[model samples]
Target: MTGSIVFDPLIPWPAIAALAVLALAGVVLALWRGLSGWALRGLAALVLLGALAGPAYQVEDRTPLTDIVVMLEDESASQALSDRPDQMTEAAEALAVEIGARANTELRRVTVPDGAGDAGTELMTALTAALAEEPRARIAGIIALSDGQVHDIERAPDLPAPMHLLLTGREDDWDRRLIVRNAPAFAIIGEPVTLTLRIEDSGAVPATGATAPLEISVDGGEAQSFDVPIGQDIDLPLTLPHGGRNVIQFTVPEAEGELTDRNNTALIQMNGVRDRLRVLLVSGEPHPGGRTWRNLLKSDSSVDLVHFTILRPPEKQDGVPVGELSLIAFPTRELFLEKIDDFDLIIFDRYKRRGILPAIYLDNVANYVDKGGAVLIAAGPDFASADSIYRSPLARILPAEPSARVIEDKYRPSVTDLGERHPVTSDLGDGETWGSWLRQIDVTAGAGSVLMSGVEDRPLLILDRVEEGRVALLASDHAWLWNRGYEGGGPQLELLRRLAHWMMKEPELEEEALWAEATGQTMRIIRRSLSEEIGPVTVMRPDGVTLEIELEEVSPGRFEALYDGPEIGLYRLAEGEHEAVIGLGPAAPREFEQTIATGEVLDPVLATMRGGVVRLEDGLPDLRDVREGRPAAGRGWIGLTPRDAYETRDVTQSPLLPAWLVLLLASVLIVGGWLREGRR
Candidate 1:
């Protein structure tokens, strides 16, 4: 209980001051005149003033509240590495015992786990939240048992007391990590993209060679090894093999005595995009379907089209001169012989041998197809004639041969059984109610798979692989009828687009492929194949664990399976000859980025509060009591400020002087002063 004197004035303070001033002046005048009752009169006046000035003794009853000490225990994944987990556990138990032994002290244990997803150690975030729950005045100190590699240091709260760190991990701990400094999210195919990387060693690194052996693999293929200098940035130039997502894995062989090999490997997933698609369109004559092919290629801004319509053949004996009829001469030599490789794809729209392009030029075109080139043939009535381009040297590479028969009948196109499994024609929509084609040339498919059929199951579309190139033949010119919305248009644009991209070697449209997509730790593994049944996919995890997962057919050709990966790193998938590599989460998780224990990150915050760091590996320091606003840590001990906080239970107040007692005393003093003056 505590008591203090307080006042409750009956009148205003100004009035009380005026009465006191009057009493003083009267006393002084009486004393100057030699009045005998001046002292008594002054006493009587002081008594009356004291009665009007209300004063009381106030007392309070309080209960002492315990001081709260927040102890943040780091339970992140990094703490589990090495012997840090045991260190953290031992330190926490010792601190709890010490806090409980202190008089009027309480311990608050806050366990901090790994952050959601890729978010690393959130030590400061947990500390801030723990402080917000308790009264600031009642907090004694804060202690964190961690590896001191905090990811959310910016979220540190203002400390009411001191914050000390009990660092885990030994002083001799060291690690080597692979860091990807600069990697583009999307790179153009066939263009050299430079990626910057660094190999860094932290802590007490052993004496080793300056160069480390680094291995790089693309799409789970064979890795190429190189000796790269450590502690320096490396600019690696690479050209993607195919379009779409490309997974590249980089790794360094684990060295002896390193903390872990998790940080020694990194995965980079970049998308391969085409800069531009160059197409050469050679039309035999101006026809209704010729514009369909031209418009389709012209609509895409990425496609660069070189279109030539063979108007006024050399055999036509017109009266007008060739110069008067044509604006410019066709440079067949420049297109077919000189820069044939510059174009990615060449289309023959009803093109025939009209003595325009010589047999040598046609032979060069066939040679172009043999060297990783794509050719699409859209045939019409002229394809069956003796003047057909198939009669030339190009016949060696074409997928189909003309049967010299053109069936003029209404028939809807249908996907063949093999086409149902091919990515190009699979999932095109329901083929039963498609629009009818007016005519289809009879052809014998000899080298390629028939993707579509019409007019009594005759081969209408064929695709083949010729050495390093691809060839596709569409045996009708009536595809424009679908574009014109005949009996409700079919997937004309989609069909042509897929067909063109497939020939150009789009990775997503490959018939035999394997890949994976990640959503958090769950991976959706996909396998595309032409065969009806395929073997189970072999998945090799980052930790060298192998799992064989059987994929179920989700669609006609697409097989998929979901696997929840327990770790984050590069995953290799293989099914027969098809192989793919994908990254589930971060290649190097944030926890493993800096595995060495250090207090540099928490130095600023600790200095502001007069706190220090103590390494648990050196021995847990003793806890001591310290005063507020003084140094809270020393060499052998850490200190906690004693917060003498209390809660008020009750309050009482009593007047110092009663009104009746004051009045009686004033009357006695007045009468005594009158008698003394009368006597004088």
Candidate 2:
């Protein structure tokens, strides 16, 4: 309880001022004239004015509230890195007991955990939330237990009391982490991309000197080790071996006394895209479709297409001598054998065997296909001729044999049941109003799967995989006419693109493949196939648990399912046909949430005013009054600095007196006194 005196004015200040002025004038007149009666009247007037200004004694009952001490405990990933978790747990329990025993003081314990992946710690955020529920005036101090690595320092609340930090880790604790300063999301397959990477030393580093040997690998191949400078980003020029997604793993040798190896390695996945895909186009004769094929391949900024057209047959040469017939000599051996490996893909548009290209060169082309090379054959009616390219040494590699019979009729092309499920030709269309292809060559039974068919359901396109290579045969040369909008056209560009990319062993088009994309702790698992149906998919989690999920058809040939992971780790997804593994969480949980842990991170203003320092180690300090701007405790002691504060429940106010009332009263008094003097 508390008490105080207060004022309750009956008149305004202006009226009181006027009364005082008149009373003073009366006294002055008495003194000037030496009149004792005037002095006596002035004294009485002063007492009358005093009664008009009212005053009263006021008091209120009050009780002091107990001080609230916030004990912020960080159980985040960083705190768990070393023995900090155990230290924090022990320290928090002891502090809570000490604060509870203190007179007029209470303890509020706040526990903070790691946020999502690599977001760091959210200690201050938790503290701010705790502050809003408690009385600000009763706050004594805030003490935080953490690893001093907080992520959300900007959200630190204005604390109402002194804040102190108890850092968790030992003085000798150290860590080695892989730091990637600048990593590109995409790189050219053969061109080197520079990666800025370094080994960072923090806390206590082992006595292995400043330099460390780090191993680097791409696409899970043989790893190469290189000596890297510590604490500085070193430029690493890496050339990708193949196209599509490439995973680059960087690892450092674990120091003998290092705390954990989680930070010793890092994985970076980048897509390997060719700067320009080199392609060789061999055209046998001139046709409207020939120009179409050239334009389609040339339009892609990423494709380098070299096209050659044979305008004159060997027998139709001019009367000039053989040497003078044409200055351009065909370099069959050089293009088909010597430099064949340089090109990523080779396309033959309506091309047939001619006297210019000997059977030996054709054999070289066949060997190229068998040795991981890509070949696309766009057959025309000439494929059925006796001099067809299929009749030469290339016949062994051809997916289909040509029959001399030709069918002339209008037929809409459609994907076969198997073709509809093949990634290359699937999802083309339902053949309602699609653009029409005018011509298609007759092909006999082929070893590969038939992707598309024409009238009477004859094979129109066939795709095959031979040895380590891939091959595709498009039976229609007139397909290009559709690109010219002969009828209602479709996505000709997209169709041809998928076809070309599929033949190049692009991972996305693999017949049987498993892959996944992650969103938070959930993963979307996808299985692509050329088969009509896929068996159940089995997923292996990092915890050695295997789960089977049924895939639903999302597209003509694509199947997918979703998996929510219970923990952060690597997960393997596999269908009956293919298998793939993906890591969802961080290799090691560093600081989760906003990682920085400061007493102010909880309530900034309150912490500053309370003279508290956020310590992640010592936990909550015993509430004690310490001097400002000095060590919180002497030597190894941990203490809280006092905050000077006062609280008042009652407040009183006064008002000015009315001037008219004061003047009227003074006039009456002066007139009455003069009347008495006249009567006497």
Candidate 3:
């Protein structure tokens, strides 16, 4: 219990001072006149002044709170690496037991986890939260059990008590990591894309050879190995093979004496697209469809179309000299032999061998189509004549042969039975009200799938895949009349565009293929088919675990499912042999790459607090009472703060005496004494 005095007053001090002065005057007059009751009069005046000044005692009771101890534990991803998880688990348990055992103190345990993305462990944020829960005056000290790495140090709260850290890790631990810095998200196909990467050493890297073998692979193909120097950034240039998403995996063979291999391998997913598609359009004769092909190819920003038209054939000189004609010669040799390979696609629109293109030039064109080149042929009436280009060396690659019979019946070109499911023409169904072609071709045989049919259901459009190349043949050249609003042509532009893309070896045209569309990190995996249903989808996570999920029919002949990834890393989905990579998170989390727990990461700041100490081996220290500014340990640690408080039950208060009676008696006495003293 504790005691203290408090004051309460009624009358002002000025009234009391006036009463004292009157009593002093009476005393002086009585002394001179020798009055009998002089002392009693003075005593009465003093009592009156004291009574006007009322006073009372005020009291209160309080119990001061005890100081609090804060224990912060790092529970981030990095702390979970190596044996750090176990180490932290043990140290936290020991520290809790010690602080709990202390007297006059309360222990507050705080757990901090790794922040999102590059933000590592938010230790300071955790500390601030713990501090807010306790009283500032009652806070004694703070203890942290974590690796030294803290992401939010700038946000650390101003702690009332001294803060200390108990780090967890061995001194000899070391790590090596591969870092990919400036990797492009999208790279052009067949063009070398440069990626900046570095192999870095941390902690106790060995003093062995500096160069290591780095094996890099794309889309899980056989990797190529290279010797790269450690601790320096290197530019790696790689040319992608196909378009769409590509996964590049780089790994270094783990060194024998290396500390950890978690950082040895890294995966980067980049998208591939073509810079431009070069196409050569060889028009045999001027026709309405010839302009349609040129317009469609020229419309795209990424397509470079080179169109050649033979306006006047060499045989059409008709008694006029060849030099006199205005038509320029078609450079067949320069186009077919010289720069044939440079073009991605070669189109022959109603082209025929009318002594204009020799058999040798036509043979060279066939070779071009055989050697991994795209070829498209839009045939006209000349296909039935002896001048048909199909009769030349190109006849072997053509899917259909001319029957020498012209079928001149108006028929609505419709997709074939198999074409209804084919990627090139599947979306276009019969009875779609498409324009009718004025002319039709009579074809006897074709090696490719019949995509479109003419009069009496004859094959009008056929698509085929040859050795390392692709071919599409449109038997009728008059199809372009539909584009001129002849008979309400339905999606003429779309049909021709898809036909061209199909001949370019687009992956979407593959009969059996697996592909996925990305929505952020989640993927909508789709398996398209002409069949009734797709079998099943098998997904492979970055951790090598595979999941087989049944797909649901979302639309006609299209199966789809959503796959949500658990982490931000590369994931693969495969249906049979079809697979694609889904990148969920950043290629690397800049922070928390090193997961070892160490006190060195947290010890420097802890040492700044004089009263703080780390006793990991000894467990939590015993609580004891110590003077302010003294060592935190030595005697038992105090658990509760001592509060000296007391309570008062009753209070007595009153005025000293009556003021009117004292004033009247003092005035009469002073006047009578003064008269007697003056006569004397």
**Candidate No. with top TM-score:** 1
Worst 10 residues of 2 by lDDT: 592-601
lDDT of 3: 0.73
Summarize candidate 3's per-residue lDDT along 199-277 as a digit string, tens digits.
Answer: 8877766686788899998887788999999989999888888987788888887777556665677878788888999
The TM-score obtained by model 1 is 0.88
- Residue 377 accuracy (lDDT) in model 2: 91
* Candidate achieving higher lDDT, 1 or 3: 1
Superposition error at 136 for model 2 (Å)? 2.3
Instruction: Give the Å shift of residue 407 in candidate 1.
Output: 4.1
lDDT of 1 by residue, 429-518 (tens): 999778999999999999988999999999999999999999999999999999999988798889999999998898889998889999
Write down the lDDT that model 2 would get: 0.74
TM-score, candidate 2, is 0.86
What lDDT is reached at residue 248 by model 2?
A: 76
Evaluated at residue 2, the lDDT of candidate 2 is 46
Q: What is the lDDT of residue 398 in candidate 3?
A: 89
